[model samples]
Target: MAQVILTFFVAYGIVVGGALCGGIGAFLTHKPPLLSMELLADQLKIFGIVGALGGSFDSFLQIEKILIGNFSPVVKQLAMIVVAFLGAHIGTICVQWLVQVRS
Candidate 1:
């Protein structure tokens, strides 16, 4: 129970961190501050929603078992966090591309 809650907290933190890094990269690359902030918020929201979905399902667990062939809770949590972060980062990029296209 506690562990499950902790896993979600840690995963969310990592996803937010990744989003912050993405925002910083955008700013450093000369993107407008407003756009960078929007990207950051969008990424965080996307990651959180996706993470929640994944947590609610067992698909990631099955994938984790297939890829790692073990059932270590810690490893599963870590993998979830990584995948969540990556999904958020990729989502941010896609949003940026869409914004550029629309402009």
Candidate 2:
């Protein structure tokens, strides 16, 4: 329960933080900050998900455990992954909204 919620926020933070930092970089480079933020948000989503999951090796280990008929951990891991995805998606949407509002 707590882990899932933590995963969600961590994933969300990754996407939002990465996008904002990328936007700042774009501004410093004389490019369009909002567009860069949108792009970075999209790009960072997968990274966020993977990061929130703490990398793929643990997931693969979970899958192996599933093969051994231990289903609980895998289910929780899947739930965490789904929640992370949602968090990343929402973060992307937020960044897009920021772009839309600024434009």
Off by over 4 Å in 2: 101-103
TM-score of 2: 0.93
Colliding residue pairs in candidate 2: none
| Candidate 1 residue runs with Cα over 4 Å from true position | 49-103
lDDT of 2 at 9: 87
Instruction: Give the whole-model CA lDDT for all candidates, comma-separated.
Output: 0.57, 0.89
Write the residue-wise lDDT of candidate 1 on 1-103 in tens digits. 5545554555555455555676678878997754665556574765564564465456455555655656675466666665556545555555555445333
